[model samples]
Target: MDERKLPSPCVVVLVGPGAAGKSTWAGERFAGELVVSSDRLRALVGAGEDDLAASADAFDLLEAVVRQRIGRRLTTVIDTLGLDRERRLRWLALAREHGMPCVAVAFDTPAAECRRRNRERVKRIPADALAAQLTTWNRVKKELPGEGFDEVLQAATEVRVVPEAFVQADAAVRREDAAPRGLRFGLQVSSYTHKGGRKTTGEWIRQVGARAEAAGFDAIYVMDHFRQIPQVGRAWEDFLESWTTLAYLAACTERVRLGTLVTGITYRNVAHLGKIVATLDVLSGGRAVCGVGLGWFEAEHKAYGWEFPSTAERYALLEDALQVLPVLWGAGNKGFSGKVLEVPDTTCYPRPLQDNVPLLVGGSGPRTLRLAARYADAANVFGDVTRVREKAEYLKAQPRQIELTHLSTTLIGRDQREVDALVNQLRPRNQDPARYAATANAGTITDQVGRFRALAEAGAAEVMFSLPNLDDDLSPLDTAGEVISAFR
Candidate 1:
């Protein structure tokens, strides 16, 4: 048998008569929790798995479990003697209702093999019953292709899930306009609510910077927020101010640049932001990047007693700031008069140490992209591979070309099982795993490599993503290095 893969977060129905190796095949390929077996349910409810008297209750429990798993958008394998058309139809309907692909894995064992295996079982079905199942299986096999299954598969030696990103990933890898300038990966630390508490934050930040730098990360970015945002955590969780912490961290690590994933344009006066980032650059020996954006999170603004301006007002302010920031950082003292702001005197001492401070504009909106193209060295955006490619095209259309980058909240694992577990930890209240995976950009390290490679192919020069487990773990740094290595 050759190696084959199926999509994750999908439904798989095993089709076979008694003792046709369906159970063994499913057991070999899937984790125990993902396989919903009627026999196991019977063992709990009845005298034993083979007890005929408990069939109705066992089936009832089985249906309930299957419905729940499908509702959650989890990969589920229905393990049963797959001869009942009615039951198969129910499973297919459930899979379709949830927009998951339903796959029928046909176990085509010879009748002689089935009877031989059945006779050797400790509790075999009646000889007459076995014969009846053999007859029913032939009919089931013929009807499966017509039953609206997304796929009909023959199970043999090797089978695995391809995950949902395969087609897009393949296309991204083949894109003609992929950035030819190589790629860089940056780690953005969003939360400090690890088990270590506030006392250990200083130590944790040092560990995080050191690990990322050692693992070949190009930069370590942090979020700027007064309180933990609702997307990353609750409002009250421990949150650190971005630049003050970055200033302290600048001393702890060498080589890797430190910057904010984005500093809100409304948080501070533009000149004040220039001074802070300049100091950080000077302190870190020129390893500093300044990422600014049109600030969202209106609730955070209200909580912090800052005025949350309307969207149009903010964009105007952002454009004004972009026009004057270079004058603030440049050699001469200059003042700015723009659409929304004017500075009387732009006199700041201790200019950024870098000859060219990397200015990043973080947003994909039309106006933001326009601002980035005119003033920023790079523009950051996010989406699946296809959307990312489209965004790269949009950026290319601008007269002044700037580097393309991506920003995402990442939850990475070693493989499918670990991916599932990580999703379970952060999966939202009543939201399906599939939906959350999209929100968090969840996948294995290998999955991420493929995704990022596609991003690189889409003309993105760098991928900046926040990790969910930065709270307590630095181990992901080592595994994440594999991605960095691919681009290098």
Candidate 2:
């Protein structure tokens, strides 16, 4: 086959049983394109020719070169014996990460022919090595596409290529069937310690809960912290325990689900926290979501006299909290003992209404992703659609089903002049007025309708908007009502 005429956006992997003339054929076939050879890299690095000691360095250099060339839209050929799944996956990830297509070409020449050709070589491999190589080759070929290859090619002189487009198409079908079809929305009603003398009183919470439910929001989320963020104001203004306020909201709002945007697992024991969430979930008729995270605010810990561990230790506690919560909520009531936490067998009353109330974790980190995979029902990310999509892809690899909810600031106006007024009012909170002004005052109601529809298409299960303040006179409830009415 002419290498230049090969498929575009594809990774063509050359594979075969040991001594099956893979390297010889690849050298002859793709002489024009960049050829990444393990042997040449060892030779350049001063390791004995073809010595495995330099294999790691050789592959590293090979990867860098291939990535650079492929990034420039050049077709590159890898000339190593691509016999195992792990080796092939490196190339597969390179292709996927760059959004290019991939193809694997395996040499299926007969073993007798392979051995006959090997006898003609100057440095011959051992028979046992060839046998083991053949065994791996057979096992990996069947597992290639599952390992993320886009196409698989089997050849014994004449090549046979199996298109993975059907698999991708089937995946699309399954996604459509399994995806949440209902309209879902959430709101952030952060409890603020009033500016100078005002308090975050029970009345304010009731008003916000009423507004959220009246505006047709699906859920009401409160911020979690011991003290108010200093950037907003002083620490002693009026801060309330997030869970305690959530309990109040649970009784006040019958329709809108109430929960924290995220609660720190640092201060509370995991088993006790699980019991609290379970009680709230049962009281609220399964309308409570437990949003947990590793504590971040150091000042809050100092203010509240709670011990703040190192980040690594906090992550361990976070993981322990996630593991123990399920056991506490489910049949396995035996206490959990981990490096960070120990819970004795003690049953709590009023198990959650839903067999499993949703566990929502907030943050964008590798450990967070793994935890979400193991325990989270959803992840709360604060960013644009592109960033949300990236997080979603990472979360998809985890074992749990994770929905993504993105938090953004929204300003709605009845007309252009009202929009301008709202933008001015919000200028103090935003870092860059011009950028936020564009997002807020981009166009008419028709434009915002289109924007929200696009967000839904981009895979956001819910988009929670952060309002300025209750007394700010710019109601997010009104804005949400308008958007929901227009879209629905």
Candidate 3:
């Protein structure tokens, strides 16, 4: 019989007795696609493929991976004996729910042949278990077509044993394991103080922009404040205006994107903020991302003489800004009047080089996420992996496909001793250093990579991390670049 050509973008579930060559068939047909195999996973998590005790955990992991792959719309193959009718029905129903077609291939090799194949393997199945599997397979094959497979095929031979081909399969599996999952990284320069700890200088800021660009950061972000937050240092400590710093950095760097971690909506009129981002987009050669949110720091607002509104009023104001900012960025003279602000038929001249200045909404509130889904190109979330995961899931379920970015403070050093020293130096400034110790991705280079992997797994599409010692030496930026590159 001729082999079948399975449909693209479908789940192919291989059904057969043990030692019937399901692994070899799957490897040949779906080498590049994700294959969730029970025996392979069992070997990975347990003593070997023969570890019956590991079966429960292996299949659980297999189900989770298959679901994830299906959610991603990737073609996947599950190489497992489908003698368990209940288990196969669950997978069939899942594919149906996702609108993906499912196919079943039943290996019809004789019980004696399967037993022969099993005897030649290191992880041999017992003769009685092999007979039971074959008995179950016969019943499963009869019911497969009616039980919800879109198509079914029958194979008459056990897989040919080839050691060299198995070696190649192992290598292919390794390459699949090594493929980079998508996640982008950016740098946020939290402090403006100079290298000698004396004063903020243009030279220092310019150096930062250049180094970050050269180090391969996707973007460089700054705090949208006129004075340092108390957690970073004294309120009087040096801080630069957000838009001005972005404009300066635009002139200093060529490739990296630039933006405020988030610009407070109430600091300036919404139309004026749009104009600023449009100009920065032109100046940066279309690298500006307008990250905005409801103003949170009452102290900073009081110090800058800006009116601080109640939390409810501030959210309402932000909702209005989200409505007005995009219109001002678009073509023609636009007029928008809101309770808190207004633009009276004014033309936004010298429009941004980019067609649309990408707006990133920053906040984790339900209302904020709803606003982001309605208006912004992305949303920024902050906190531990668990919070990040929860927010990511919630936002993903929202109506739009807004990008989710994680904002974090990353502390790094060459060794544990160096890391402890940095932590000790910053611990007195605020409880944050110790708090970060529990949740923030901090420590040596090796530790940071592991932490980043967890963030990616948690569904953060992009990340912006502030290095505490970015001003002291540029080496950490270089190291971070290396790590990001390697991870990608």
Using TM-score, give the best candidate's number.
1
Give per-residue CA lDDT, model 1, range 258-344, as digits (tens).
Answer: 898799999999888888988899999999899999999999898879999999999999888887877787877777899889897
Candidate 2 lands at a TM-score of 0.59
Worst 10 residues of 3 by lDDT: 158-167
TM of each candidate vs. truth: 0.88, 0.59, 0.62
RMSD of 2: 18.4
Residue 116: error of model 2 in Å?
94
Candidate 1: misplaced stretches above 4 Å?
1-5, 31-33, 41-47, 53-74, 86-90, 157-163, 166-181, 420-438
Q: How does residue 303 of candidate 1 score in lDDT?
A: 81
By the lDDT metric, which is better: model 1 or model 2? 1
Residue 273: error of model 1 in Å?
A: 1.0
lDDT of 2 by residue, 77-124 (tens): 676778756667877788777776677777777777777877777877
TM-score of 3: 0.62
Runs in model 2 deviating more than 4 A are: 1-181, 193-200, 230-234, 429-432, 435-448, 472-474
Candidate 3 C-alpha lDDT tens digits along 61-130: 8899888877765567888887888878888888888887787888888887888899898868888888
Candidate that would win on lDDT: 1
Candidate 1 is scored at a TM of 0.88
